[model samples]
Target: MTQSRRYWIPSVAFCAVLVTGGLAAWAETVYVQAKTAQLRSGKTSLDAVVGNVKYGDALDVIGRDGSWVEVKTAAGAKGWIFSNKTSSTKPSGTNDTLARLGHSMRGGDASATTASAGARGLDKASEGYADRTGVSARDRDAVDRMTAYQIADQEVEEFLREGGLGEYAK
Candidate 1:
């Protein structure tokens, strides 16, 4: 009786681990919106069509090979799809807003609003964020451009000091 119980416990534990691993491997999901989606297992053109996918269909994505996503189609056809071709549902306005702010900062158009104050605030914010993120190597150009605002602020301060505007404070 004792030997049978020991074997049964180990078998049940092994099956539980396999089942959990399998569930974790099948977590991603995707949807096909184009007329037909091309499924490829690899970068090679030899990746055969696991199946055809249709428009507005949901798929259970299993894994990825390079840039290709392995998915099971709504009709139960499993295959791979190019990552770039996947339709992303991000909000359009976010991109536009980021672009506008990026352009304004890059162009150094301070006169848009109290130019000096605006530039100082943006420059400080950018530097603070960059320091915190520490992965600013990808943001080098942006951080450099933002630093321009700090330079501009120092220039204004120097002009005021040399022009005797500093006497006004006394």
Candidate 2:
């Protein structure tokens, strides 16, 4: 009975170690967050490019060196990528409001024109009414002159220095 108990204890201990090691070996998963991420052969940007990953591509993190992470792709390619280029979650689509608006306009969304006009503080109905009522050329000329006005660089610098703005702050 003593011999049996000793063997059982060692077997249980070995099994626990195996399980713990296995869990540790399971690589952490991350996704490429940049529009284009280059996986390099070394931790530094000067290293040879080993692979290219687009936004949302999955990578299994194997290790890290400073700001770089070693990873393996689903295709079994292994390389290093900047830690900043990868995220634990997949990247969402473009965050640019202008890009989204452009897409909406290109897609022919019925409300896009109205939304764009509203953004400029103008309504389509009011614009059409004004057009029908004849907008003053004087007002248009004033706007054009205002847009064409430019300040000399030296004068702008002087204004900034006087106002203690940004790098000009005392």
Candidate 3:
């Protein structure tokens, strides 16, 4: 029994090391779960965008920095994408309507609202959601062309700083 116990302990330790080593050598893969994930040059939203990965796109994870993930795109683009935008498993419904919305979030009559969505305020309805639960789909989508708001990181930082949200908030 003593001899068997000694062999068992060593065997278990060896197996543990082997398993951990094998897992470490294996590269982790993730799929983009967001409508559109911007691959940034760095691990921050303020970083320059290197590429865009669509929903359900597979990404090879190379490393991780905080909430950011370093990945290599199928097209050979190496960049950082937010960890929250990716999924451990391949996403379903890749061919679904919502998945086919394309890169632009704004759709339908997008050219209608035009310049009315800016500092002047939104005087128009844009790309209304289609809910068949209560309202008719046709009635749900009132008008389109809602101006997309693309606020820069700098602007947000300035606002937070002005409000004295705290130190190193950015």
Winning model by lDDT: 2
What is the alpha-carbon lDDT for the whole of candidate 3?
0.71
Q: Per-residue alpha-carbon lDDT of model 1 for 61-161, expressed as tens digits?
A: 77767656777766676677766545544224334878888977798643232335344333445545656878455575564556464445447646755
Weakest ten-residue segment in model 3 by summed lDDT: 123-132
TM-score, cand. 3 vs. native: 0.45
User: What order do you get sorting by lDDT, best first?
Assistant: 2, 3, 1
Q: After best superposition, candidate 2 residue 16: deviation in angstroms?
A: 6.9
Check candidate 1 and list the clashing pairs.
none
- Give per-residue CA lDDT, model 3, range 139-166, as digits (tens): 4334222333467755765675677542
TM-score of each: 0.35, 0.47, 0.45
Stretches of model 1 off by over 4 angstroms after superposition:
1-26, 87-170
Global CA lDDT computed for model 2:
0.74
**CA lDDT scores, all candidates in order:** 0.60, 0.74, 0.71
- What TM-score would you give candidate 1 relative to the actual structure? 0.35
